[model samples]
Target: MNNLLTGLKNILGVGLKPGSYLNILYLLLAFPLGIFYFVYLITGFSIGLGLLYIFIGLPFLLLTMFSWRLFARFEGLQARWLLKENVEHDSPARWSEASGFWNWITSRLSSKYTWKGLVYLLLKAPLGVVSFIVTITLASVSGVLIIAPFIYKFVDYELPWGAISTMPQALSLTAFGLVLGLLSLHIFNGLAAVFRWLSRNLLNSGQRLAVAE
Candidate 1:
């Protein structure tokens, strides 16, 4: 697992920072809010503005912002971490003396890189949606083959291709099923590889953002 993650950092165009493993690091922060977002959507909690703001609206927006900054910092950090470079990040030593919420927020705002990183994080959801749909589609076709015999009962007998009105025989179906099941693994692995590459590029903006910084 460490080697795979490390390879991701060092791979061409990935350019993750050594200590910045920020992408993996900050994923935890966004997790709980994600759960809440799903629940809120399911419950249809849009009637009350105040409640919606606190529960549904606010968490979603904040998570979006949080995900963005966190991942950007991750990308930047991963780059530094992998390359073993000590890029200068804004020093926060003096902020320990001053004690105010507004002051801390101001200090964070001063570093524009964080905001830049945040923008990158916001893009993650859309890329994720595409990745999910493609992967799920390929995997679902494979799953249908795996359970071909059982599928006859569950799936309505209308052929989408309009090729056959009646269901296929169990023996032939099983043969095709076996072939599909085996081939599906190869296809899934290939699709996963493509998606993982896309994710590294889309989510880990370490190389480009680092140069921009």
Candidate 2:
């Protein structure tokens, strides 16, 4: 009985942790960032591929490659700050004045991280959509139910069981909503963990590029 009670407390008390809110915030931003990355990559690649024969597209393709590396670096920073993951500060490597522009460009083109980061950037678009949808849906439903007691009289409220007309019914709905909200927090935390793992693997996995003299 004690073990069961402890387990219940651990599951139900997720909202008490500050990290829960951080996870929610990260998940909330995932959708917009994912969409932006997708659009930028697609546009850059399309234009680059289309104009390659003219040689003008070479620069565009190079720019697109560099852009994704930067995006992956930012993602690592975000994971470190928001998800509390130990992600490298400089991922996919960046240009250095000492290294020379050509050396930097060659290092990036040859690094495995460049392609892995590209794959991650593309995958996040769909993942972000799922994260945003689930987070919004759960939070909205919980919020509405929690506030049922305060606005039931002003607005017509109906539940699956029946219509809510009495204070007792409203109070019951509020209680249920509170429980659901707690569960939603757990779900958000789980989603954040998934992103954290992905970031660690794709963004933080390989050795840093050595700067050529």
Off by over 4 Å in 1: 1-94, 97-107, 110-113, 151-168, 171-213
TM-score of 1: 0.39
TM-score of each: 0.39, 0.90
Screening candidate 2 with a backbone cut-off below 3 angstroms (N, C-alpha, C), the clashing residue pairs are none
Candidate 1 lDDT by residue in tens digits, 1-213? 998987654442232232223322223233343344334433332333445645666555444444445545554454344423333333332456537754544444555555544443444444445545544564566566556566666665344554322346534455675666545444434433433343344434232222221
Worst 10 residues of 2 by lDDT: 89-98
